[model samples]
Target chain A: MSWSKAMPANPVVAVAGATGAVGQEFMQVLHDLDFPASEIRALASARSAGKKIEFAGCGQVPAGELIVQEMTPESFKGVDIALFSCGAGISKEMREAVVAAGAVMIDNSSAFRMDEDVPLVVPEVNPDDVSWHSGVIANPNCSTIQMVVALKPLYDIAPIKRVVVSTYQAASGGGAPAMEELYSQTKDFLNGEELKVEVFQHRIAFNCIPHIDVFMDDDSTKEEWKMVVETKKIMGDESIAVAATCVRVPVLRCHAESVNVEFSGEVSVEAAREAYETAEGITVMDDCSSNTYPMPGLLAGTNDTFVGRLRKDPTVEHGLALWVVADQIRKGAALNAVQIAQLLLP
Target chain B: MSWSKAMPANPVVAVAGATGAVGQEFMQVLHDLDFPASEIRALASARSAGKKIEFAGCGQVPAGELIVQEMTPESFKGVDIALFSCGAGISKEMREAVVAAGAVMIDNSSAFRMDEDVPLVVPEVNPDDVSWHSGVIANPNCSTIQMVVALKPLYDIAPIKRVVVSTYQAASGGGAPAMEELYSQTKDFLNGEELKVEVFQHRIAFNCIPHIDVFMDDDSTKEEWKMVVETKKIMGDESIAVAATCVRVPVLRCHAESVNVEFSGEVSVEAAREAYETAEGITVMDDCSSNTYPMPGLLAGTNDTFVGRLRKDPTVEHGLALWVVADQIRKGAALNAVQIAQLLLP
Candidate 1:
């Protein structure tokens, strides 16, 4: 029963925090991508440990056979790459140890994003930054990642002077419990009963929550701050200003953005379309004629960041506006970390 | 038995789109505010001409007793003030006619919005504009009326250089049929059947559509165009820029907007909050600590525009952002029109 017909020599690739939504997607992607992994390891919290997990119908992964091991620096032994989709707290606790053990840790938490030693990577947007990873490559924020992937190529065509983005984020980014919050609250509301709130500060079923992450003294939430700083880092432009208002939409999987951009020089709507059409990991859905454009329902399950609603900002001399939608769980998180792993594969 | 003994000398008022959602709200507001209307002439089209409607248990209003008349010039001859929430075509043909009959027409339609002679008024934002109207005072687009009303006073204090708003609109804005479409589609989706969309181009059961109105030559839709033009006319600053992405959400009422504002001078988040708190018709719902803010569930049945998530745009020198929620059919269209009628008491 040895399956050794076409495996790559990367030894074994492990996905830490592998039982959650993003974690499950990581396993599916590894199999879907046919990554050259000689061995595969699925890990999660100790409680989720010993759970049976299968990959690509690769037969049964028996319970208690592969215990959900703890994420420790020692856990990185013999692993060529570790895709970390665990929270920043977990990444902080074990990332150093795992990287010290020789595995290239691609952390999907904010712990290392602003770290000068860590290179924040969006393969299509800034693959060049990958070369400088100090054994710990950082994954940008979910909202920030998709925005940069959509804005980078456009920025190259016409330098962006400022970016105004307001995100309608999906609940899946909050992990499984937040998904439960939306589901349970929705049923309660439809039944004409008062919805109980816990996972969120307010009822999230039929409403939009303006707060994401902890609020700063300045009133901006941490999620909003990410778009501000991450854009400057990923685009390698300190002069280009960015502002964001992130909202938690009742949607379950995709993150959508309405973006207004001001460029340093004149850039027509057609030119902006040309810029995105040629960029990798980006798709232009700018068919305002049929009202055909990027939207959450369409972006779900896809890997590409959808960009649309391209038009000249009639208010400014060199400005254009667009609507961006992307699968936050995919390109915004798990898929991106996996792609970074692919870049490291032999 | 003459009930005239109890009636004040208040003039008679008529509601042209009675029986519609906004019309019902108008009736509620009249009762709540104890508006000094000696009598209420509940008016509607021929089909609903014989239906009995109730409001605050004021007594049943028989549609047939409503005169079962068309909204003709002559129908308005006795109306001291006509508050209209009818369709655009109906309002267009009757607006001037109503005025000719010595009644002030407050129309909730795009039919007269861009007309230079018709003043687009959001009473709280600019009651003075009411004086400029010959007789037909226009209600700005539902989305525009709320945003500008929330931003107008702030714009005066800081002078908005640019505004980028992404609206999460409700189905009722498209009228009752759209609301039915949302409900029916949800049931169909639950039954595992493919949902058929009639009111919208795509399935909107649990989805958000970025399209609103037909697209124009410049790629902007009629909905977006109205917001841009109406904001200027209502704000009396044609030079003030606005870009909007109007979306139809699954909700039943209250349109929410994520607004990013870049002003001429530095606008602190604190100053913005104070500005909204002082602005007429604007209710500041900011309290990110508890996540208490503008939400449709809380905003439904309300007349005032709710503002929250007020924060400084950290990316720009002079920027402030917000999340604004208001009952689109009410503040966005109906109540605002009613408020204008209150401005001119004979």
Candidate 2:
């Protein structure tokens, strides 16, 4: 049940797509957990090989390049856990290969999220579901992960029939290219030059982009679709009716969502506040009397999903409105994957 | 029935409380509108006297001291048009006095908005309401003014029933001292120094403050109250049920709102789009295909209320979600007041 090379017994960890943003974050998180690892392998496409990354603030020897070695049954040798953070295509191609090689795969992609056997884990919301993963565990989308982390506790108190959320997502969720585009577009606009947008479909400087991913036949993007489906899976209710309008803001790191949840019965504001206060992995910063609520700048570099602006929705009989913010790179991707690895650690 | 004497001759214009943020904006805007003024009287409290301000854009005239004069009946003697940008107390103190002095007072404070006598005007939404003002025109609250401007066109095409809005208000809505506090607190947070909060009840640096103004018995703040009442007054419809959550974000100038509106009849998203396209004082920017949407930064320094993220609220039968952004200092306060003055000009 372990990937220990020597009988002395220390875990061997493998980081798939280790050079990407969240992938790099996963490495740092693992070292921060002081994961009892005898060895660590930073794997990526051959294109990113020999790229050295320094793991500061966490235990690290110099990071080695991931060779262009094809992921196969033999690739998971001596590895107890494989944290997959590359794109969905790579995860889909190699998920079974790594798992068949006898290592547990904690994937930070959307490939196997709907797979009934592959548990979609947000740890705080559904750690018990992790036991059901066939071989690979799926990480929920960044927006979905933060929201359900806050919504789960509330949903348990009263059955949530509907959720309407509008997300002010960050550039990090679009990967390093959109991050570079944000920086470049901002610099261009600041310099009085025309903004050039490549990664984004439009100019992202000083503007909110409503389209996060390509639209489907229903006009909902893939990102919004993830929120709708993933919430159903994580909350263990397919009838949970969720609708989302995903937007990308100029913010650099944290993603924010303005969420309104309607329940089956009357959920008073005070009761909801207390529920969030006691909720794990969720921080209730709701203090409107003194003007303190959750925001992206405040949630940056934090693992806890900050939830605030909690108030009763006067529109519906049993409705609550809140603003939730979390670091997409951390809790949404890296830290969640690392948590799964820690859970599976011998 | 014009206020300008130029036609007419020359209109004597006075800017009450002409030293504050919107007051200064009043003077600039008066000149920008080519206000037919033989004399411009700059009035403020005794505290802000002997301050010479040159209205360069207003024909490069050498400005005199900001007179330390009480807003009494006699002081408003020759003012054919008196634009009042003073506090609510000042408006209450001088409204009758200015009326007796034979000057039409356009007060930009909350003292007279709900009053049946004073007609609240957004011009874009209810310009005709201005004709009935009994020597004292009421200016709607900043947030309310912008919301109604965007909602007016939509309401005409489809009768609106309920409006649920959560505002991402700017620091400028609270005036200059609050802006100073925002900068100071931000620097303090960055320097790891003690955060100083004076105007706002809480530290607004890297945070969202949900409470604006005093709280009402209903647990909503005075701000939320003003939006509800003023929208009714300006739109001339008390039947529209409205609820608002006013939030102050760290943003300096523009205020953004996430609005969910429902109508009595089924209105297609395309119909709402058409209504916005033809609406005056509004710029429709709802192209979600290319990531184009309205944002506070782009709306700043402009008078138009920019709206985007136009989509059918999948949860409701005739509901649509919209994001509205406008420069609070300009369209929400200064420019709006100035535009009202423009209507009175020759």
A1-346 per-residue lDDT for model 2 (tens digits) = 3233222236667788777888778877866676666677777777766676665333333344333343445668877778888888988888767767667788888888988778888888888887666678898999999999988888878999988787778889888888888767755654578887788777765555567777765556789889999999988898887768786766677888878888998788888878878888888886655556777855778889998877777767788878898998999899888787666643
Residue ranges of candidate 1 with Cα displaced over 4 Å = A1-8, A57-73, B1-9, B57-74
lDDT of 1 by residue, A1-346 (tens): 1111222455467789988888888877776666676666777787887787666722132222344665556677777778888888998888777766667778888898998888888998888887777678898999998888888877877899988888888888898788888877877776678888888777787677777889888888899888888889988888878888888877778988888888888887777777777788898877755668877865688989998887888777788888888998889888898888787754
TM-score of each: 0.92, 0.85
CAPRI category for model 2: acceptable
Error of 1 at A282 (Å): 1.6
RMSD of 2: 4.8
